[model samples]
Target chain A: MFLALVSGNPWLESLARLAIIAVLVPVTVIILTWVERKVIGRLQMRLGPMRVGPYGTLQGVADTIKLLTKEDVRPQTADRWVFELAPFVIVVPVFMAVVAIPFTADLFIQNLTLGVFYFVAVSGLSIVGFVMAGWGSDNKYALLGGVRAAAQLISYEIPLVMAIVAVAMLSQSLNLAVIVGAQEDTPNIAFQSLAFLIFAIAGLAELYRQPFDIPVAESEVVGGPFVEYSGIRWSMFQLGEFVNLVLISILGSLIFLGGWQWPWSVFDESVPVVAQIAMMAVKTAAFILFFMWMRASLPRLRIDQMMSFCWQLLLPFALLQIIINGLVLVYDWPNEILIPLSGAGAAGAVYLTYRAARATGVRYQPGYQTVGSVL
Target chain B: MTYEEVIFYVVAVPTVVGAIGVVTARNVVHSALFLILSLLSVAGIFILLSAEFLAIVQVLIYGGAVTILVLFAMMLTRVRDMPAALDGPQRPFAALAAGAFMVVSIFSMVSTEWPGDTNKINVISIQQIGNDLFTTWAVPFEVASLVLMVALLGAIVLARGEEGE
Candidate 1:
């Protein structure tokens, strides 16, 4: 169906898609920025951006205009071309990743057989932009931030991909649409809850939201990689981050929340495509709110702790989920049996982690035993 | 020009230019960036050939992982963003050998008659590759992974050194 439309003029069709993506991503980023600020503000007992257009809806627009009007600055020691190129590099892959995301049954830009792989691979490319921004800035703070960002991204990516691999295993397909289809009988969260949890947590770290946001800790490195960026360039990085937040939320919804499918098979086939799209948007919005809630509530983690969490805890759980999934698939276990077994496995893993943490005195700190005190 | 040829040149030009830039760039960071561009354009070529899986893997492994690791190592060594001359004493001999290899490769390419499949290219899906890797080539695949594991252990031991180990 899509091939027929593009067969008339492939270049024109591609151009149209590119234009839509270029406009859509920035617009989504704008609204998402406002949404985050408002949600986070309310969480902290404040009215967020109330003075701008009705209920601060136009705040993102105003901010964009203001950023556009502001003077762009570059450090004297900064790498000229790379510093300028970094923001576009950051933004483009995010839009590229969106190409494989099935917005609705027929609403996606493109649906490759390797949709999940494409999204994961393209999303990983954005770290280069952060690194470039950091290194190009030529400031020690920015450089440190860039290195930290790269390190954190590389570390968290393993668990993120592993969780996605689990989903692929359950669905038996890498295509997002097919994954959604497989959930018609039941959402993946019913059985792959462990994988869902790991994906969400790793995704949060990948996005560098609070707790995992050591790279951009304002008190520490001062905006991390984008410290030296000013005006439009800085805004681009901000927009890219917001876009990423939306993308991760959408992915979580599509992979675990059954996408546009109605839960329990209620009106699963009878529902109109528009309403299905709306359902996807609503599910994605729930995740966005959850992300904001996490940001408001969680304290920043030490970099070492963050690294250990990904490698030690998340990696093992993700690997275990995969093994359980492999066993279920190989043994041809019924869902009734497999779901509870996997759930028990997940609970056991959590309990063991808690016990290990307690043994190490990490969960509850011991009373002060002075050994090489400043005194 | 035919569409495929046009697309080929479009991707190939940058790839060649990037390769040249990687060799000639003064800054090590710039060289690394050029290498990324070269790899990405190669990925683009893969896409043009309808090998989407391979293209993404190229982007993931080479463009994303290897280039970033190279840049990371360069930064840790405190050489990044510095204006260091890349010219070495072996430049002339290296160029001579490289030029000879290029000539030989071009001669071989022109001499060879490539087997052409006139049929429509069927995209080999990721599932097929995964199946073949685990079933048909399982032993080789496991061996490759074991090699990687050994290399990883070696790096860790080397980094830890005498007292730490």
Candidate 2:
């Protein structure tokens, strides 16, 4: 239908695709905002927004209206161009990642051969936006938050990329559609559970959600790099973040949960397009819900602990998974062997976390401490 | 001009402007941001050439990691106090060195016997690159990794400082 409307003009086709994405993303963000509020409210045993629309369905719309009408404030001391451009810098890369992401095998704006790599590469560019917002604000809290964000992001990016690399290795392809197709019989999660765990944890850090949201820790930095933003500008930042949450969930589903592919290949034939999309949506929703649950339940980690977790525990295990994968692939070991090996690695990771927590005595104590003592 | 040529100019103009901005921007943070713009535009050029792997790496490392490191360092230090840091007594020497380097690079670029047609995009697969890196270029790959490992350790040591201190 889209191709028919656009005829054969490549430029028009591209523009139409982008136009659809532009509309789809904001609507998704609005729905997600409402869903997050309600989910978190349920987790906290409180009623969320109940006054906007039926079951508060229109709360996001109301908030959007408010934000759009609110004054766009910029501090007199703020750098004009940097302050203005920071939101676009942060938001555009996320939407760019969406272009390469496949919903169903055939559903994507553009399916690049290096889809995973392109997503990772483009997403990393947002760190610059964080720093820009922080510095441009000329506020100390914003500056601190921005720097913390950059540090946390770049640090965790390693484990995240390594986990993705492990999956790419398992699938022996970087293309998203091909990766999903490779998991037609067994999802990569079956053998690469450890990588999935790393991906989830690192993804949590990447999104700066709870337990890893030290950059924007409300009690500390007070919204971090976005402290100075207001009105529509602030909405743009929130839009980017929620959109990123959706993107990460989608990517996770595609790579690990056998996106658009039924479990056990029950059909033994091509699944209908609708069923495939439903499968993708269900998996992505599961990830999004899991993230929301974590946000509600988990306490934010200290900066030191967060950094150490990524570097010490997550990074090593990620590398170990890759190495084990290499050994199995090179030696042509039976695929079943990976189940036990990865399971053991996951167990080791859990045990190490338990030991680390016990050694640090992280219960009910909050104060600055040496990194070595915590580690 | 062809569509590819049009896109090339669109990207290349920013690349050149960004390079100039990096040197001319009075504020250091602005300079760093301009450096990112320049790096990103170069990545765009790489995409045009169909070296998608190199382009992604360029964006990932240079545009993302390296510049963020610079920005992080800037935030940690007194960046505002050094507005005129780029201007100093060594200007003449710096200019001479930059000029000489530019001439050498341009000469090398023009003289090189390039492979393949200028108009066609040759797409290379990541698997082939990985295979060649591990097989034919194994030593160089290992050496590169060794150098990176050494640098990583050196950074840790420098950051840690004297143990007792």
Best-matching candidate per DockQ: 2
Q: Taking the candidates in order, what DockQ does each have?
A: 0.45, 0.64
Worst 10 residues of 1 chain B by lDDT: B79-88
| Candidate 2: regions farther than 4 A off | A1-7, A266-268, A360-370, A373-375, B110-121, B162-165
Candidate 1 iRMS, in Å?
A: 4.6
**TM-score, structure 1 vs. true:** 0.92
Q: What is candidate 1's CAPRI-style docking category based on DockQ?
A: acceptable
Q: After superposition, how far is residue A332 of candidate 2 from its true place, in Å?
A: 0.5
What are the runs in model 1 whose C-alpha is more than 4 Å off?
A: A1-10, A348-375, B80-85, B96-100, B107-113, B116-119, B162-165
Tens-place lDDT per residue, model 2, A1-375, is 766879588779888889999999999999999999999999999999999889999999999999999999999999999999999999999999999998998878888889999999999999999999999999999999999999999999999999999999989888999999888778989999899999999999999999788998899999999999999999999999999999999999999999999876667788999999889889999999999999999888878788888888999999999999999999999888999999999989988887877773545544443454344
Instruction: Give the clashing residue pairs of candidate 2, or none.
Output: none
RMSD of 2: 2.5
What TM-score would each prediction reach against the true structure? 0.92, 0.95
Comparing only chain B with the true structure, the TM-scores of all models are: 0.85, 0.91
Question: Which structure among the candidates has the greatest TM-score?
Answer: 2
